[model samples]
Target: MKVYIETYGCALNKGDSYIMMTLLKESGHEIVENYSQADAIILNTCAVRLETEERMKQRIKELRKIGKKLVIAGCLVSSEPALVMNLAPESSLVGAQSVDKIVEAVESPTRRIFLEDSKELITPRVFEGKISIIPIADGCAGDCNFCITKLARKKLRSYPPRSIVNAVKEAITNGAVEIELTAQDTAAYGLDINYSLPELIKDVLEIEGNYMIRIGMMTPELAMKEIDDIIEIMKDRRVYKFLHLPVQSGDDRVLKLMNRKYTVDEYKQLIKEIRNKIPLVNITTDIIIGHPGEDEEAFNNTLGLIKELKFERIHLAMYSIRPNTKSALMPQVPDPVKKERMRIANKVYEDVAYSVHSEYIGSNSLVITTEYGKKGSIIGRTINYIPVIVKDYNKLGDWINVKITEASFFDLRGQLIQ
Candidate 1:
């Protein structure tokens, strides 16, 4: 059988698609490049936000017109399986938890099936031939009022430190330059078994991987608990110096309403401590504007903090109320208000992004070459996770020194220092 996979949502989703492809191949199936040529079409859907879900719906509708024997498998199928069935009646449904069962779905004649529970099968996957993204854990216990994903994901369960180490070992052996450790919350890793992120990293680093490990996004609440320990552990040569902490809001009232345990002030203190100790560390965060009950003052407070922090990257998303989440029932934020607030957040981010990026104009950075840019430019990212576009491939994939000649808010243009 030939199968085609379409992935949406975060890096995790992409990782799942890769795993599915690899598993299918191992299970006597061929993975096709195009849906038109495949025996089946599988959409690894994402429902992170209302807009993303709508886009998935739109894609499903369009694909159903031409894509035959469709399979809807991802967070969307997990969270709203019935809705997916309603839309694509003939489609098979699978959830994020059911990622390992993609081959069965493709071969079976089932109309709708759910296989989303418990994770830890040692599924090591590499995405886009560039990096390895391994799921060291899955599910998040954090019950943020605005999150629907939390509901869909089962529980926080971290794989044994040795398991992750083995996966990274295999990935490195496969010529992966990067090993990305991901989950709903990397900070919550091992809490179920009384282990911690630091312990996990130490184990993985000992696996003798030439590739670098990029720790996925972590909440400040969990990360701040053992900041010292985390810093010490992450200093390993294999670990990248990038930390992504999501701060949904910068206002206490809004934070409380959103069920976020930490106040804006507490999050800021964590940020300050981390940056104070690790100067030049790349700090990135997620900001969700228009979360229920977010007022103008709250929004501005967020804006103020963004200005102060000057994040290397800001993943700003307009609040999208998911069904069954606590915030969705609270006074509905007007769509127009959400749009305006998103604009404000984006604008603030734009200015800081370009301005902060400009400082590297004359500095040299170690970039992992990913793609070639137009007109003699090759693109990669710094150890700090900032995108740098180099004019030539002194080499791609291998780390190379780039002296920044010009910088933009979103990317940097550099010349090969060699």
Candidate 2:
């Protein structure tokens, strides 16, 4: 059978899609690039917000028209299975934790649903280019009021350290130069299994490879517990000097309303500690504008925080109510107010990001080519994960010295150093 799979959402979802594809291929099915060439189609969906959920619904409707055996996979199948059923009653359903059962879901003749949890972690033989995404765990330990992902992945299930180590080894052996350790909350890994993330990193570092390991998003509260250990592990040259610690809101009141567990002061102090230890660490964060109970003062506080931190990257979003979330019951900010706040926040982020990236101008740095960029350019990343684009280089995993020639808010353009 020819199967076509489309994935959405976070790195974890992408990792799951890889697993499904590998499993299907092992079961004598060919993975096709286009939906038109497949006998079966799998749509790995994400529903973190209402807008995303609606998009998934519309996509499902379109794929259903193709009349192939459609299988709805990932978060939507777990969190909103009924809605998926309503949209396409004949489609098979496979939940986020049930990816190991993808072959069953795809091959079953009648309508079927596979929501059972699997304890084993399956490593993908195929990867995206030279980068491999390895999921260390599923679910998280947070109870944030605005998070609908908690409903989809309700429990923290950390894969065994041995399993994860093997996955890393497999990825490296398969010629992956960039290994991304992903989860709903990477710092929450191993709380359920008595293993620690630092320990896992140490184990992975022991693997004989030339690849760089990039850790994924982590909840600040959990990260605070092992910040020092994490920093120590990151000091290794093989690990990317990047951290994604999301400070969703900057006001203490808003933080409390969102049940983020940590205070604004605490978050500030954490950032201070991290920067003090790793000055070149690239800190990226997420900010949600106009969440429930965010007044003008709260929004200003967020803006102030953004300016103060000067994040390397900011993933800004307007609050979108999700069903069954606590925040959805609260009064929403007016659409106009939300839009205006988002506009202001976006401008602030752009200015800060451009200023931050501009500092690299005229600097010489070592970067590893990771992927090809647009118009015959090769994209690479510095030790701190700053993206650099060079027009002359085509080697995909080779390290090259680059002179930073130009900067944009999003990336840096460089010239190869002879």
lDDT, residue 388, candidate 2? 96
lDDT of 2 by residue, 239-323 (tens): 9999999999999999999999999999999999999999999999999999999999999999999999889999999999988
Q: What is the C-alpha RMSD of each candidate to the true structure, in Å?
A: 1.7, 0.9
Which candidate leads the pack in lDDT?
Answer: 2
**Candidate 2 off by > 4 Å:** none
Tens-place lDDT digits, model 1, residues 1-418: 9888888888777767877877888888888889888889999888888889999999999889985788888888888887888899987777888777777788887675866573445465445565778887778868888888887676777778877777777777778787788888999998998898888887777776457778898988999898999888667666677999998787889989988889888898998988887776789999888888888898899999999988988988888889888998999779999898898789899999999999988888777886667887777878767778776674557888889899777888888877
Runs in model 1 deviating more than 4 A are: 116-120, 373-376
lDDT of each model, Cα atoms only?
0.82, 0.93
Number of the top TM-score candidate: 2
Give candidate 2's error at residue 182 in angstroms: 0.3
